[model samples]
Target chain A: MPYDKIILGAGLYGLYAAQKCGAAGQRVLVLERDPGPFMRATYINQARVHMGYHYPRSYSTAIKSAHYFQRFCRDYGFCLHTQFDQIYATSAHFSWTNAAEFRHFCRAAGIRCDDVSPSRYFNPGMCDGAFLTTEYTYDAQVLKNWFLTELTKLPGVEILYSHRPDKIEAVGDVWRVTAGEITAEAPFLLNATYAGVNDIHAMLGLPSFQIKYEKCEMILCEVDERLKNVGITVMDGPFFSLMPFGQTGLHSLTSVTFTPHETSYDPVATFPCQQQSEGRCAPGNLFNCNECPAKPASAWPYMSQLARKYLKEEYRFRYKRSMFSMKPILKASEIDDSRPTVVRVMHRNPTLVSVLSGKINTVYDLDEVLQQ
Target chain B: MITNKEKNFVSAVVYLHNDGGRAVEFFRRVTAVLDQHFDQYELVAVDDACTDNTVDSLRSWAAGQAKPLTVLHMSLYQGLEPCMNAGLDAAIGDYVYEFDSTAMPYQPELIFEAYQTALRGNDIISVCPTHTSGSSRLFYRVFNANSHSAYQLRTDAFRLVTRRAINRVHASSENLPYRKAAYAASGLKMADLEFEGRMGDKGTGRLALAADSLALYTDAGYKVSAGVAIVMMVLALIELAYTLVIFCAGHPIEGWTTMMFVLTLGFAGVFAVLTIVVKYLSLLVDLTFKKQKYLVESIEKIQK
Candidate 1:
């Protein structure tokens, strides 16, 4: 039997590719190793629907991804929760200084950016409030679930569980793939795993490189009540913005830099582990999550001091429940394979395309790459 | 019974007044302590809409006293905010301080000090009549560490906001009062004096109960249970670690050679596993709690 397309991974992006292929009434095969789509990495991300901060970082890709995400939610009937435009501090200037003009940029793009006053912390005088394009943060798991739940029923789309793909090779005119145990052939292969694609790229002898993933472990302070009588999402600064997650009464927070790239998968990096769990012992290392015995987090060296200052009083905000960590792509390296130019006889080939979807902050120069 | 030597005083906003238990006794003490200096001042009692004999006792006390003591009652029990607003509206004194019926040996002089401080600075919003027990502070120190990493990014954005700057933090379609710290800055200056041997448990949020109890107990309104979360997380990590072992070992024997059927599932499996792993790690280090910005805590349909 001939398969039209074979996609690796069932993440939102991979599923999307499958659905697209399946729509053509083509045989679509989706292989996922994890039990189901409920836990796809991107689905488990901050669930922060990107607004339009991408213009300042990487105008083109930000626009494309933002447009894609917004439309995807609209098309799929997913309720993305977001307040108005975001808030930035006049007190500080980040790598990009013209942040104030982001409102105009949004306006020119037919989006809204209404300015308002800053609350006590930001506004002792209360003067800074602006409404720009808002990010729609939905339950990423829910959306992923919806897609899996809905798309699995589509015609010609076959979703297999416990199937791990091993390698891909182009035999004759058709592309042959050896995944788990079966060797199958298809015309086209689309690789979109944020990190897993590197292995496939390597298998294809395609220059695929792994960009380090930085994970910031955090506990969400579940908001006990609404922000009191007001319906404003509270965001504090520039690079990191903390808002209230819907219904969960949790703050969609932004405070620490998640250096997942440098983060190790060792059990020693378990302070954050214990902190993630019911704390083992209190104040063992109140200043640092890393030093906390029975519970420690391996973050910045200075993070402990910060933990002492800010995290010390976290219980003040009603801890309804906690969500998971959010991962952003920090670097995307170009893939280059250097094999002596061989005639068509001694064969070798590299993977054709690699697609990535992550927070806009990491796409420093996306158009430049996409164009390349 | 009008002691001419009594210190001048104003009204008190009583909190957690269920049935106004011991209101009469508290008023009797108030009269004895400040009766001399407080002649024209009225005793404004925020009834908190107590279900007990609070209103009757105040009226009975009013009838006998040469001074007029009025009760500002709530139609429905609205919580500390409405009770405070009602008291603030009714208070006719130069000073208004929170008076807890359950107050623990608080010197009458402390209230007087708050009054003095208010008189000294019009910008002083309110005084911390009570000090957080050192134990409470320690809990917060730990709490702060957990939350700081999460909020550090945004706090830095607003760090330069001046006292007069107007930054409005809105949550549920309405504006909150300057994010809690706004009260800390807006004409509300708090001073902590030593209330020796007392654990600062006046009305509701008395943290003087135990040392680590503050961290564990969501008694007042702290909905974010770091303790519970911590427990759930450990279980999740264990599950995740096992899953990781399964994934890395590539042990599941299910044959997946049929390319189209399971291609995506394989990669997605790793993705899911990574999520569990990453999220598990983030638990201990989570600094800021989600503001619980959506749920309207007051809109609960409590039966009257």
Candidate 2:
């Protein structure tokens, strides 16, 4: 049967789009490359719900995030973890934004930012200022379960796992995608694959986006009782962020310097590990980095040493494990240090729209394109 | 024959300042040597506010390599000492190599040789050329004569240091104005490796750095002030003795002249001693309150 919309990935964007379309009584088809949903970029990230506190250099990005922070909390309050205090501190050295600038940015963006004593949690002379902000983390597992249960009961939505389209062709105002023995056709095609956006475009014989890929690692740790209810992020420079990972008891530790193990400038993701992946991953098709055999060594020593340099000795943590994923960023955003969600209408006849965003709460940017 | 590479992680830090042409060649040679000798390594290039295209060219060249290359940009035109100190602080490895210049005058084998020397129980290893310029030799001679450190200064092309030495130097001072002087005074075991090559041209701000190092690390400044005070005291005693002899011999010397001379000499001697005391107190204040000396604009890691 023909469907109204066909979505490529089963991550948050794809799932949310499917739910929206299904609720509207439009037949929707979702194709997932992995066996499960939210198994890659959506689940293996620093799950902090952005309250516009992360971006101090770009005013638009911060204001947009603050605008969406409220809507996302109101919609998904069941899985939102708001029990911990989130602290954003500016480093005393090597920081682009000083204490005064950070405070000014927060005030202009109209977010909750209150100055606190830096010496309470950080080593003396390490940080210039610390602020207690209103931010929350979402439990990806609980969110994933909620999406699964809601989408499964919808009569108009159908999901296929472990499925990848090998051929995509345009046929008279409809897109026909085939993978092995199954084929699907839809008038509107949405590419919510994030890192695989270029790969999908290559299959359709369309122009590739000027983007770069980074194989990033997020280390999970077990924090002490003193830091269990606290989250700390040193901002506007090469610093680290340690925050709660979803509803899980573990904390996610990531550093701007040590988190990214390797980078590929090609539009399509390329790495040395692809040679030994045995067809599981390649430039045209990406497999999960967390389950790959040839992933780079853990950068625990570098990250831990960086955190210890700023935090006091009492705020202790032990390394649990590392989660790896592919991150793609627009090359133009490098100068302004802004992460703007880009929704490009590549094709008008078949209605091909590709969504690319870095932050989680910016998922609502898909609404305008989908409405069109 | 089978060759086994070392398993230790290494970080090589090089600073570039308006040397766009030489930086590419230097990076190529250094990366080749590091790749052949270690299982894992990283290159950290410090951009000392270059007014040329040095960083752009290096970034393009680094796009084809697989190992990680981090570029640290200084906010302003800070000199070699503070810029390299910032790069060294960013490095995370069991052993670190500090390349003083972008000119590779020596063979590539010298890099691994220095690493081997570091493994043989030395916390710091300085690689210098056998030949030195006349001015540098004179400066080192003067500096070593007054320096109380066990290790002597040299015209080093590059050096290798263990993590322990880095920690010790950081613990010894709040601001590292001169890395070589700090390492020499770190009280850690150190060795020197000499090669048979000519050194390149010296970098900018050398005279000012030389002056600052001598005043900060050597006892020459204090000694000069103390010597002047002693000379003033001796002159005051001589004048006192002369006044007593004149009064006893009845040479018709004016009473006002004798008293004025004695008072002037005595006050000058006391003020000279006070000058030395003030100098010592200021040095203590500087050591205790000075902040970090370097400011980095950003750190960018390029991996291809």
Candidate 3:
């Protein structure tokens, strides 16, 4: 079937483009090479939806996308969740010495601040005090499903999952998409697989670009019932930022940084930065989990030390579960990874367009990427 | 008023690995208490492996128990995962609760409460322990145990994921105690019940037993081990001696040198041994101070 738009790769960006183009009354067909529709790359996310207002860019698009998602959930009858309340914090040591500096950073980030009682830190030296933020955490996986469900329901939309687009290009001025025995023709094509940008570039014959990020993370869960009660605490610093997915069962204490290399996004390479400390103890009475020997921090005592300075002598560490990973991205300058991201090659007409983004960035603005 | 319509019944599944000599006694006590109520239930005993009397004890106990007790004796130890899975598979009740036979036998009320609670339709209800911390009212209000927001969020995800398919996925062994994450992932609804005292098997121990310890003890219950107290105690003493040495050494040694020495030693000690303390603390805090019910053979839930 010949359509107006053909999207390459069924990840966040590709799906976002598919949804928007379909919403714009264009028949959109999305081809994915994954064995399944739920591409594990970016769809199964930590669900950290970006407000994007924090950045210098025109956030109107992001706001529109966020609202688009909200509307999608409401209209489709699926629930997508985001944390209404967020608390940003820093170690007590830093808060005491650099109050103005901290306040300034918060102000610029467009977040509100207060000097209330300091919340507790799971890792002893991880962070000290917390200031609340208005940031929301929308569940990415749910949102993705909802978005796809809603988008395909429209008249001009056909979102297909698990199709390897063998050839997609402007063949004789008409774009042809071949997937096994299935064939779809379209005029416009889009690619949004960040990790596989080179692949898409090669397929579309577009210039390949390099993408880099500073640090990625491994998730930590503090097992003590005390910690579970404490809920989510946000500790902020230039180096590490501790945030909790308390509602979702992920309390990630960040000292580790992960960057996806230009060539790879293998979540295992990056390790958490060692937390630096010289003082006896931070302000909060960090509770030691002297219960289970199997918790993550307790399991990696030496590694945890490298992430932070141990103030207490022989203090027990408590951890529940840990999902270990280093972000699979580049920390250095953007260098082109020469792989075709466009699953298919459109003949000569502009049938598909693709963009690659670091995992830290959200595919909220689907319309902006695909519309232009 | 009992209606003619089919009312949802609630029951728990209790799994017993090779629970050493205590297997028979614990099983007897459990059947005795459960039989008193005459509530519909299933008890699955998975004998991982035993060179001892565990199987013999089960054979005799199973011959006479009034309730439905299914015994699965695997030839070898597949670890706790397979044993729990075996027991879970055997559970035909609306709610399948997990318990460790090595801890004290489950308090009878826990069964009644858990069954009643599950009938009300909680996809996954975390059992808040009422015994350990002494401050019941205070602990109940805090977030679900494991303070990590990830745990909190994963719980909801588990419920959503699991409840969508009522019976197919059973419960994930990956997320326990706070099975809420797995519950969300399974698309299950959630409700929490607070245990009044404690699950029976965990009630003993010199300190307090946690779900973690309960799991371990239950996993090890297949053994003839009244174990680990001595090794743990000796390790504790050595650690203590090390602490005192630093404290005493700090007084006479010059200023910075003593502080430096103490700090270095403290880091090394905490780095090496502190995690065990936290794991144990997670166990204790989960049982004593927290406001959720721990698992037993049967946990009650509220139905839709």
Candidate 4:
């Protein structure tokens, strides 16, 4: 019998979609190109359950985050590593919002904020102000494991590893998804393929998104005992965050100005500008910009140079390894550097729904959209 | 409450917004207490958009501190709630304490006691003011009575939380209008200590803040609206029954039946309108805090 839903990604959101559908007593088939789960954007992320602190400019986003922060902890409390405190420090040089403005934003968004000293791990000379806020980092691998375990227990759900959809077609009310030598049919299809969203859209003869893919890297660092169990973020205008490295007990440092670079596949776009693709991808083969294996490049020097300026006792931090991935962002959201999850159901083709999940905490938003 | 041995480092978070003339002495007293209680400690001072030189004073004092000192300066005045949250995030200590530095009787001495209380395996150690203002007490009574969550909040702002309790508060902080209430609702082991309430300038808008916090923790407005609407409907039904009895007895007053029918229909209309408004409010609250499924950024670590 044809499946009720064919989800085209086994990433966090896809897995969640499958679980939601399966729990609702619908048959779900989740297909992933990677041999296992969390091989894409879902795995290679800071894994922060944001509480709207990141979005000082967008009150709606921040408020929504304040809500999601509670639900995420309650539902996936086991997958969270709340051992560390997360700090948001205002940049003395380039932050768009001053310490007071950011605090005001948090208040308006109904997010909790506390004025804390920067001497614990941050250099007071560099930071104008610092705040300790309500935010947690998730162990992505552990979260994926939890999802897999929970999804497995549900009836009428099948997750296929190494199943990449080469072609997707809508025939009447059912969607025909072709993966390698296998072809599956489902009444509804969800395109949760993160970076590969446009690729799948192109395969299904759909309009290409105005999405831009930035070749980014997450620099893992081995810090001494002093920096353990602390997640520190310097608010934007060249932002940087030194967060606890999931369950590894290390630290992950990321810089906004350093990681984002326009790829050749990206339309002619200005730096710090989002670009839209008005044209559709050519039908036939998948045209995913992130198809190539990412090579670890020289990001440490730039990252460390910026980090040392803000961190206290910079000597303790040592570079370990770099993980490269493509970060998909809307052109508009790139300006403020904050975007809510984009969940769009095809109006003409009700069977098809596409989601560009911006954060891990946004799966609930997808659940709501799917229900609609 | 799962209590572990006290870690070496203790963190004290002080909210300093508009603490003008007393700002300097407040920090000095608080730090002195912190110095006495623990060998290793960090003081997190949150400058809550103080127009005065509060941030400057904090910076100058922090410069000389032997222990770690972190000062957060809010760009805009975010009140006490955000300041508490910010302090929680910056604290790295095994035990974290929060108190207003400008409270008339600067009680840095209480920090040690609160820490000791927490050390005894209490998840939350809160300092209850000796004299609770009559109005504030009534507000808490109503708030606790109407609260929708299982754990009811009883104490005030001053608190010392353990690492685990801190985690729970941080997890639930965003949606909670008041941090103290969220702590009480966390289902952790709680202990309350009484402190002499020093008379100072009572902050204005206490009632407004109380009402706002109550609305935040429970569906107070929705519940009242629902209840009132139900009463109106019930009254309208009773009036309709009386009017029907009178009409059946052929003794309906001239134009009385018409007026009663109109009034009954108006009550029904009001009920319908109120139900729609209540639902809309509920939806607004739901969407306002609905967790969006994704964010713009991504983070990954090196494979072990």
- TM-scores, all models, native as reference: 0.43, 0.77, 0.40, 0.52
Model 4, B1-304: lDDT tens per residue? 4434333566778788777757778767777876665555667777776787776766676666665455666656656665566566545566778774467442566767877887788988877766666676677788878875555455454778876775566445434446777777787888987777743433655665676666666667667777777777777777767778778988867447667676867777687767657655765575356422112122111110
Q: Write the per-residue lDDT of candidate 2 for residues B77-170, one digit (tens) a residue.
A: 9889888888887776679999979887789899999999988999999999999998899889989999999999899899999877876786
* Candidate 4 Cα misplacement greater than 4 A, ranges: A264-296, A347-350, B1-304
Ranking the candidates on lDDT from highest down gives 2, 4, 3, 1
* Model 4: DockQ score: 0.01
Q: Pick the candidate with the highest TM-score.
A: 2
Tell me the tens digit of each residue's lDDT in model 1 across A145-200: 66767676778888776666656778765678776777777665656455454445
Best DockQ among the predictions, by candidate number: 2
Stretches of candidate 1 off by over 4 Å are A82-95, A120-133, A228-239, A244-249, A256-352, A359-372, B1-304
Candidate 3, residues A242-311: lDDT per residue as tens digits?
A: 3344245454444421211112232221112212222211111111111112212221322233222311
Better of 2 and 3 by DockQ: 2
Per-residue C-alpha lDDT of model 2 across residues A140-236, encoded as one tens digit per residue: 8999999999988899999999998888899999999886678999999999999999999998889998899989999999999999999999997
- Cα distance off (Å), candidate 1, residue A296: 7.1
lDDT minimum window of 10 residues, candidate 4 chain A: A272-281
State the lDDT at B298 in candidate 2: 76
Positional deviation of residue B253's Cα in model 4 after best superposition, in angstroms: 99
TM-score of chain B of each: 0.48, 0.91, 0.47, 0.78
Q: In model 3, state the lDDT of residue A50.
A: 41
